[model samples]
Target: MYKYDNFDQTIVNERVEQFRGQTQRFLSGELSEEEYRPLRLMNGLYIQRHAPMLRVAIPYGLLSSKQMRMLAQIAREYDKNYAHFSTRQNLQYNWPDLERVPDILADLASVEMHAVQTSGNCIRNTTSDQFAGIAPDEIEDPRPYCEIIRQWSTFHPEFSYLPRKFKIAVSGATHDRAAVRVHDIGLYLVKNGQGETGFEVIVGGGLGRTPYIGPTIRSFLEKKDLLSYLEAILRVYNRYGRRDNIYKARIKILVNELGKEEFTKQVEEEWQHIKNSVLILDQKEIDRVKAYFTEPDYDQNAGDDTGFESALNENSAFTSWASRNLADHKVAGYKAVVVSLKAPGIAPGDATDAQMDFIADIADEYSHGEIVVTHDQNLVLPHVKQADLFTLWNKLSEQGLATPNIGLLTDMICCPGLDFCSLANAGSIPIAKQINEKFDDLDYLHDIGDIKIKMSGCMNACGHHHVGHIGILGVNKKGEEYYQLTLGGSAENDAALGDRLGPAFAKAEVANVIESLIQVYINNRDEDERFLDTYRRIGMEPFKEKVYENN
Candidate 1:
């Protein structure tokens, strides 16, 4: 994890003082609710249905043990004793008093964290692949670039107040774990023909009321011109993106209104002027940022211990966890382990103070003192040695953090729906719990195979329902809560927006509807095909026909 320098420290300190004063003014009634809204929002505070929610930015989803401890402390001291981790890998506290926001920001700054750009219509947190360093297929570490963008976008004068919020995701691997396709600006780090590293840039991709899989504006952007080219794209959108209506204000709307060819031409014209400027990265800056993310020291001689294998054989629970939670690392003696937050009936990403303390202990004792917050709403100890896997698994299992259902149907991605969110139409967490409890068998999940079941309480798409293999969007029909289903959506290398499957189902029927859809897939799929591949082979027609056949 990158340590904050004097400049970083200074900026955050000043912002905390400023927000403290702002909170004072708001509570004293000098600033009206309307006036205090944007100020608090800029600092990542939202007035929710019941209470104020404060979102703290976890830059690129990287956290040190110290930072994790700070989060646990905040949960205990400021608001509730639990915090909800968001889909963007940020953490949210739901019960903070409006007057105490500055105190909260001060506490966060103590740990070198803040709530900046977490809300309001500005460039939000820059996301990257959660498995960036350890993933076997990565082209390069994407966090350095994400950090660079964070520095550039933070309080950017011109682009600070855009028509709508802007999102950017960078993926170092060919596999798109970061859901880059659904971002306003998606950058894929690619190697050119000569083996030189560059980027494949996409623009106008977003998920909301109008979901769009961004178009490729630049197939190969040189490493030096990364920032310059991005500036050009943002400049184009800032100048022409719709502002009259909130719904039509995203860059995706602009890209749709103007065809890809014209949009590309406009960006190209803008880039020609700025490509060679100071924004172009040189080796020194790249090295400076890369140094922060250099691989941690490991003991190479720490060979795999048969103890872990024995534990797996002896304990069916451990065996199940190893199957789902553990991932192969590029290094011989190390494995990447995902600490699931989506337990059977808990909030999807809510981690309690004790849970945070337990995981922090595991990170330090077992896998060095580093932790990763995966975009899939899970925590990761990215460099655990194979010899210590069993010990770590035993500890995690003790804490109820050892659900081994990664990428399976039960390992769902869900937003903090109506349970906490004011924007939600129905409850997403309970629905996720219902589905998780319905499909608790790991072998059954593995047999069903590689399905992303994303649910959102509303169309805000916080859970990214638009890109789930089986997407569920909650809707309200005459005050009755219902869910709309979409199929064939994906967030990988071949990203595509899901198509809706007929009418919405009442809250009671959601799990059964999903079960019926999966049954249809099992009956129709060819030999050993994944859910995505099967869906692509035999479009939504078959699943749709079977799901709504009774109607």
Candidate 2:
């Protein structure tokens, strides 16, 4: 984890005071709502249907145990007793009082976290793989680059106000766990034929009203030119991207209208001027950032533990949990354990104050005093010892944080729909509850295999429904909530938007519809194939027919 320097601390302190004044003025009627709107947004405060929601950025999803404890404190004192971890790997407080938000910001600044750039039409928080440095298949750690971008983009006067909000993601692993293809700017660390590492830069990929898998604007971008090239791309978009319509203002829309070839050409022309400028990253600076993410101390003698093996053999419940929740690590005798927040009746990404405090304690005792927030709304103890697996599992189970459904159907990505978000047409939490109740059987979920069910309350695509193996979208039909279904979408190496199944189902019928789709998969799937693989092989007709046959 990167610690804040004096300059960083000073800036944050100043901003908190600044926002405090702004918030007071707004309340005292010195500043009107219209005038305070952008100011509040710049500080990551949103006026939702019920209250002001405060979104705090967890840079690149990295957190120290100390920071985690602070988050727990904030949830306990400032907002409700729980916080929601979002799809963007950020945390949200849904019930914070408007007058006390500046106090919350001050508390966050003490822990070196902030809410800046979280809501505005400026560059948002840069996200990356939760398994960045520890993943066995990684070419290099992407966190350094992500941090570099965060430093460069935060409060950059040139990009302070774009036509629409922009998102950037980086991935260093062989598989794209960060969903880079769905971002405004996606960078993949790659090796050339000569063994030189660089970036494969992709632009214009986004999902909202329009969905696109961003095209590779540059086949290979040199390491030294990363910032310069990114600046060039942003410059191009800033100059030509639409400003007339909110829906058409995103860079994805611009890329679609201008065509990829023209967009690439313009970015290249813009790059030539800045490529050799001071923006070019040198080895010293790169090494400085890289130093912050160096591996934690490991016991070199750590090897296969007999106790761990024995425990797996003795307990079927632990075995099932391990199979789904644990990921392979680069180092032997260690694993990255995902602490699932999606329990049977809980909302997808929520953690209570007590749970956060306990997780902080566990991270200190087990995972090198660090924690990671996954894009799938789970917490991760990235460097857990294999020898302590059973003990850790038991502790997590006691906290109700040990759900063994990592990639299964119940472990779905869902947004705060009508319950919290005014933009939502339907209630996502209730629907999630219905689905959880309908598919409570762990054995049945295991039998069905990995199915990503992403739900969005509306078309903003906060749930990333477009890339789910099974996508559920909520729609308003004459004051009643109706759910639309899409199948075969994926956010992996082979990224694709899901195809829509015919008509929308009524709210009560959603669970039954999902069951019908699962049954169709069970009937036609080949041995060893996952839900996504079977859906791709069998296509949409079977699932669509099964759902709409009785309609």
Instruction: Compare the candidates by TM-score and give the number of the best one.
Output: 2
Error of 2 at 83 (Å): 0.2
RMSD of each: 1.5, 0.8
User: What digit string (tens of lDDT, one per residue) describes model 2 on residues 1-551?
Assistant: 78888988998899899999999999999999999998899888999999999999999999999999999999999878999999999999999999999999999999999998898889999999999999999999999999999999988899988999999999999999999999999999999989999999999999888999999999899999999999999999898999999999999999989999999999999999999999999989899889999999986656757788899999999999999999999999999999999999999999999999999999999999999999999989999999988999999999999999999999999999999999999989999999999999999999998899999999999999999999989999999999998998988779999999988889999999999999999999899799899998889888888888876
Stretches of model 1 off by over 4 angstroms after superposition: none
lDDT of 2: 0.93
Show pairs that collide, candidate 1. none
Model 1 lDDT-worst window of ten? 300-309
TM-score of each: 0.97, 0.99
Candidate with best lDDT? 2
Cα error, candidate 1, residue 110 (Å): 1.3
Global local distance difference test of model 1: 0.88
